[model samples]
Target chain A: MTEQFVAELRRRATIYWEKHPFQQAMLAGELAPDAIRAFVSNRWYYQASLPRKDAAIIANCPVPAVRRRWLERIAYHDGAAEGEGGMADWLALCDAVGLDRADVLDPEKVLPGVRFAVDRYSAFAREASWVAGVASSLTELFAPDLMGRRIEAFRTHYPWIDPAGLAYFEKRCVQAPREAGHALEVVLEYARTAEQRAACADALTLKCEVLWAMLDALDHAYRGHR
Target chain B: MTEQFVAELRRRATIYWEKHPFQQAMLAGELAPDAIRAFVSNRWYYQASLPRKDAAIIANCPVPAVRRRWLERIAYHDGAAEGEGGMADWLALCDAVGLDRADVLDPEKVLPGVRFAVDRYSAFAREASWVAGVASSLTELFAPDLMGRRIEAFRTHYPWIDPAGLAYFEKRCVQAPREAGHALEVVLEYARTAEQRAACADALTLKCEVLWAMLDALDHAYRGHR
Candidate 1:
């Protein structure tokens, strides 16, 4: 039954955000320079929000080993003492994309729609069962493939973007699978009941909605501009 | 200084939803029937979210007195049993506005923008300082007058609708002031330091933003539709 449930999760993964039009446009190298900048700026909000989401999960989870395992996610984004970690990589991407770091940092610069979506994502982590929260992040299961495609897409079509800025995606190529594997192990181990398994799938769907809605915000704001 | 901070919170209340254009239109009875239905439908999401927000506060708070006081909020919305409290009042409002009960319960019926905004509000209560969460409920301070106005508006302008549905607003007119007073006392008594007081005020501002954003979603979706 667990194996079947895993199959169901994989089936549901079709809605994973690689299918979002904005991501498709990026992978196809169809996004304009400004579109790329808008994407980077808006996505920065998600990257920044992630540490809080992970911390919320850790705070809610009962098991010490799970909490210890999850602690790395927060550290991965926030770093040891600032100016480091995945957040720093994102800022580098922002710089590489020619966005002003100050503008990227400004809360007002984030579209209301993007703020709404990201807040919902963080809220789900804070409110849902710990296993469900971990399940929602199984989007990482699909992330490595998209990251690889994104790296190649940027290199081939958007060559003007400094290759150094791609470090976030490149690192994620290694990190996401490892993280997803751990998360999957946790969810499979802990979500033993039928209802619990279904909730994990629903949580993943919610996460997918979050990602898709965020891109929808970007698409609305920058799709037609220039 | 706390008095001054309370004044600051009052001053910031200018952005409250009563000032939102959608509310302005509704008070003027300019909303079409469909607009009224959409408002009732979307606003139900906010109504349903309140109990969980209150529960999250109770869960996070250390003081038993505070927890005991806060528990009433969840009860007020959810009632002693399902289908008997503010949620029932809202479903009654939906029926009076010509919406199906099942439709209101259906998650898919909610607008993405409204869901995003409501989720953000719930998340704030779950994730912020317990005092700050209490402070956010300070919108109740301004809510009584709006509830009064809403009752008068529906009776005078939208008279075709059954007056029975107005029970929610009418109850709020009485309940809000009392609730707000308790919330203020908690904020004033517990938020002792300057930084904590500022955070309390900030939480109020965030709550105002949530209300305004919900109206914005309604305005976008039902503004022009007949």
Candidate 2:
């Protein structure tokens, strides 16, 4: 049943945002310069939002072991101190793409649609079961493949962007699968009932839709530019 | 100083969503049939979201008096029973607009942008001080005028929509000022410091921006249709 459940979760890859036309255009190097800036800048909202949701998960979880593991996820993106972690890496990417760092961090720079979609992640973590929160993080399972392709695409097509800015994507290529494995272990152990497993599957679908919806807004906004 | 502070909050009317072009087009009765549907459909997300945010404020609030008062706002929207209240009236609006009731309630039908903007209110309510949450609800101060005008607009321009569907607006025209007055008393009593007053002002701005941003997404999506 667990194997079948995991497989059911994997089937959702058919709708994974990696298949999104905006992402496809991105990997194919067809995105305009402005579109690239828009992605990096707007995406900063999601990058910046990660640690808050992780903190929510930690706040809601009762188990020390679980909280300890979740703390690492927060630190992974937030780093040991300010100016250090994945968020900084994303800001660097923004800088590499010629977007002002202030603007990237500015709430005004984020599309209401993108902010809406990303805020759902935080709300889900705060409102759902801790196990379900972990399940939502299963988007990591699909991230590595997209990261690998993105790195290659950037290197070959968007060579004008500095290599250093790609560190966030590069690190995720290694970090995501490990995190996904950890999250899957937690979900499998806790989400034992058929109903719980189904809820986790629904959470995964919500995560995927959150991502796809973010791009839907971007695609709508940048259609003319693209 | 309190009068000045209240005056400052009132000044935000300039940026209130009543001024959004889409809203302007809406009140002017210039919106196409498709635009009206998009407006009603997407506005449902915001209407539906109101009680949840109010609940967040109530949950975070320790003051029973405040909670008692705020609880009324939730009941006002959600009604005493499921089939009553503003939500049911909104479903009627949806009916008037030709959208299916189930589709109006479906999370999938909501624009991510609209959802994002609306979700921010909940997050703010959960994360900020209870007093700040009341300040955020100060958008009620601006709602009655818009509601009155909206009723007139629908009666004058879009007579195709059933008059019954306008009940939500008609009721809010009476309800909003009373609610806003109560919220202002809370803000005036609690936000005594200049810094606290400024934060309340900022919260009001955030609420205004939330309303504006919801329309931004709708405007972008239905621009050509309009």
Best candidate according to lDDT: 1
Work out the TM-score per prediction: 0.54, 0.53
lDDT of 1: 0.84
On the 0 to 100 scale, the lDDT of residue B98 in model 2 is: 85
State the fnat of model 1.
0.00
lDDT of 1 by residue, A84-191 (tens): 788889999999999999999998999899999999988888779989999999987855688889999999999999999999999999989999999999999999
lDDT of each: 0.84, 0.82
Error of 2 at A165 (Å): 1.0
- Mark the regions of model 2 whose C-alpha exceeds 4 Å error after superposition: B1-226
Chain B, candidate 1: TM-score: 0.97
- What does candidate 1's lDDT look like per residue over B1-226, in tens digits? 8779889889777788898999899998899898999999999988877766775675456554565466567557765554566777888899888899889988899988889988888788877998999999998796667888888989998887899998888888777898899999999999999899889889989999998999999999887963
Output the worst ten-in-a-row residue range by lDDT, candidate 1 chain A. A59-68
Error of 2 at B206 (Å): 28
Backbone clash pairs for candidate 2 read A113-B113, A116-B116
